[model samples]
Target chain A: MGDYFVLAISSIFINNILLAQYLGNCPFLGTSKKMETAVGMGMAVIFVLVMAGIITWITNTFFLVKFDLEYLRTVVFILVIASLVQFVEMFLKKSIPALYAGLGIFLPLITTNCAVMGVCLILVNEEYNFMQALVASFCYAVGFALALILFAGVRERILLARVPTPLQDTSIALVTAGILSLTFFAFKGMV
Target chain B: MAKSLTQEFVKGLWDEVPPFRLVLGLCPTLAVTKAVENGIGMGVATTFVLVFSNILISSMRNVIPSKVRIASFIVIIATFVTIAELLMQAYTYPLFKKLGIFIPLIVVNCIILGRAEAFASKRGVFRSFLDGLGIGIGFTLSLVALAAVRELLGTGSLTFWVKPIQILGPSFKPFSFMVEAPGAFVALGLMLCIMNLAGRK
Candidate 1:
């Protein structure tokens, strides 16, 4: 239990998927303009990430290893992720129109997002067993969502906050991300 | 024809600018920028794959129908990535060891796919080749910059030509953090911010 908590917290802050690890910076800086959109995109990412993790784990263990086809891992994993995103897109569009609207285009974009692929690769690197891989994937997704939402919340405030014209957009956001990343480093000793 | 090819080449250098402006190919950019040597290795490997894949995809663009272009592109990109992986393993074995999974992770880099779909699919073969070369070099330059900063600060020394040319000062003591993950974030974020500032005024 303690170990699990350590992994979870460390993953959230110290090994943060966005700020620290830089796995998901595209959306971290891209879709973070609005709080609502960021949260929606975060949720969409969490969904894909968790699923990608599980599916990739299965494929790696069962197919890649068994068939001695490790070279095919990238192609197979990406195809799984792309198809899964498509399915999720359709499902979300049908069942939860409002949520889908919030996520919308970002859902499709998740197919190419490095964060999802990074998690899968990390899991493979860590050599996590099936259960641990799933847990790690979930933890990674939650961490990703947490970082995105936090950055979005801060960016939302920054947008309204009076700041210099030159540092308004990307500059300010980057500095904020840098500070956030440094803040996350405090969690290192905890783990 | 020559002019159009030149446009594709120049566009990737400035307009597309994979890492800074477009934000594609984040994994390798953030992963291997710890050492200048690692950065160059990753950059060259990626360039070879990108250039070749772009050339092949553009040449065969018409052969592949629109509906399956994405899949075809992936296959083509994956093939070159495999070739890159094998070559790296064969010659630059140590750098390959350092890069580890990232060498394979290059397959999922969105920059490759984005180019295949956005530029390669529409452009002619010669133009696509040039696009790949320009974008690849641009990417390599960006990684070099990122790695230079990270290596200088993180380790306080920079080493080029990994083997057959060992060079580290007696006072060298690595900061260690610069080579770690967080340093990647700091280096890339600062680089991007600086680039944005420069482009502004």
Candidate 2:
């Protein structure tokens, strides 16, 4: 139990998926301009990533390792994620309209979102068992959401400030993200 | 198609560089560029995927159903990525370890997919190949440039292969931060800002 707790805290804080591990940053910047989209993207990521982590872990343990098809893990994992995103989208649309409306636009984007793939790959690489993978995936997804929401709040404010023309959009945003990452780096000592 | 073949290739070097102009593949741009060798290795690996996937997709552009085109494209890209991963493991194990998971992450690198969807799917085979080559080089240059700044400033030395060569005076203190995670974001951000300023002229 304590190990799980530590893993959760470490994944969420010390090694944040977006700020530290540097995964899933495209969406981190792309969808983070607005608080609404950031929140939506966060929710969608948590949904998709947790599912992907579990599914990929199972697949790796049972199928890939069982048959010595481990070399195909990369191709298999990507295919699973792409198809999983599609499957989730279809399932949500059919049984849960309200939820689908909330997450619909973000689902397809998650297919290519490296955070999802990264987490799945990490789960297998770290050799985390089913239970640990669940805990870590959820925490990492939460961490990604945490960073995105905070960054979105800051970005909304930065829009009001006067900035140089060249550094206006992504330039300033990245520098801001750098500072944000520094703050996250502080968490390293705590771990 | 007013642009000449050379122009198509040249544009990616400056006009449409993947990381800077298109901002397509930011994940790898920020992650693996702690050193120059890793940067070049990654850039070459991505270039392989980009060139081949573009060739395959462009050649089969007419046959793939539009509805499932993205899936097919992904499969094609994933195959090349796997091949790249294995090749690196076999021949460049050191780089493979340095790059680690990122080598596989190339499948999601947006730049490759962006080119495929926007350029290759609609273009001739040779043109798609050129587009891929151009973008790949552009992406490579961007990584090398970013890695150069970080490695030079942070460590006061640049690495070639495995050895670090001291490039600065012995008295120089390494800025160090430029090579850290936060530094990557800051360095890339500032570089983009500088590039914009330079391009303004």
What TM-score against the true fold does each predicted structure earn? 0.89, 0.99
lDDT of 1 by residue, A44-130 (tens): 888789898999899999989999998677777778888888888899899999877877788877877888887898888888888
Reference-based TM-score, model 1: 0.89
Q: Which regions of candidate 2 deviate over 4 angstroms? A: none
What level of docking quality does candidate 1 show? acceptable
Query: Which regions of candidate 1 deviate over 4 angstroms?
Result: A95-99, A161-168, B1-4, B14-16, B163-183, B196-201
lDDT of 2: 0.94
Fnat: each model in turn: 0.33, 0.82
Write one digit per residue (lDDT tens) for candidate 1, span B150-180: 8877767776767423245658776777776
Q: Where does candidate 2 chain B have its weakest 10-residue lDDT segment?
A: B1-10
- After superposition on all C-alphas, the RMSD of every candidate to the true structure, in Å, is 2.9, 0.8
Q: Which pairs of residues have clashing backbones in candidate 1?
A: none
Q: What is model 2's DockQ versus the real complex? A: 0.90
